[model samples]
Target: MMKVANPPKVSPPANEALTKDARQYGVVIGALAGFCENGSPLVSLGDRPALTAMTLVDVGEQHIGMRVAVQFEGGDLGLPLVIGVVRDNSGVGSSAGASAARVTSECGLSATIDDDEIVLIARRRITLRCGAASVTLDSDGNVEIRGKHLLSRAAGQNRIKGSSVSLN
Candidate 1:
């Protein structure tokens, strides 16, 4: 009787072989976050390291500054693939579909349509606040306040020009 030993598996050298791939997180930059061209979402770590990522699905047209996670096959930065956008605590940079951008927070949910329509739907009320002015729109739509306070102050001249002027 004789016993035989099998040879060990051979692996390429570490330096000569391609590194195993892993997911890396980065921020989206450039003009339109590289979403306008197509489904390719460009992710950038800084100025030098940037690559066009092939996403699982179209991440839609995102804002200039958005967080994204990408995976590089065989640790090759040149062949990066996009997973999805990394949503922050505020819930911005969320893509509902290939043409929709949504943001949900404690305040409310806001979405930006690809065609340039911004729709804000709130459970309670919606408030727009500025430095010295504010507009409050309630859910019922019965109450609409143009400004926080009533004031007639114009830099040049105050003119009330309308088709019909009625004071109640």
Candidate 2:
């Protein structure tokens, strides 16, 4: 008689009759419709009913037309839960919704609302880098940098007024 090398592990048969939870991708059609006691954002998903999702702990806002991933209840037992947002599909840099302010990180880079007031607080140092310019502010608000600089530019005229003008 031939001996079996090893028996393969077998999983118990799934109960197809019962609802099975699954993860799915969908787009956020509506937002800010309502909120749960825990402050979870309730949003209407594409074609499906509205459901509340566990958002980022410090997420200030979620807007419509944002693509999101959701977890569907097993065997269609109940509404699905929003798991996370799909960043690549999110039209962040486009001018579609230019009026709104959005902050996000994608592809190893962080994007902030252009020309908007932003405050960065760091215990040690804060560094910003761009292809054209960079800024650094130390804990004591003293910094040194190398670059062509501009103080201010206005449509009508540029003014530089100070107690004393010294050029070296």
Estimate, for each residue in 1-168, the C-alpha lDDT of model 1 and write its tens digit.
765587666443343233432323343322223432344555554333345656664565444346566665445556556666666577877432445544433223333346567676666676667786767777786444565568789899899876797998
What overall lDDT goes with each candidate model? Answer: 0.51, 0.45
Q: What is residue 5's positional error in candidate 2, in angstroms? A: 39
What is the per-residue lDDT of model 2 for residues 25-102, given as tens digits with 9 covering 90 to 100?
333222222344466655444334446555543233444334454554443324445555555445441122334333
How well does model 1 score by local distance difference test?
0.51
User: Top TM-score: which candidate number?
Assistant: 1
What lDDT score goes with residue 94 in model 2?
16
TM-score of each: 0.35, 0.30
Stretches off by above 4 angstroms in model 2 are 1-38, 55-59, 62-64, 73-77, 89-168
- Measured on C-alpha atoms, candidate 2 has an lDDT of 0.45
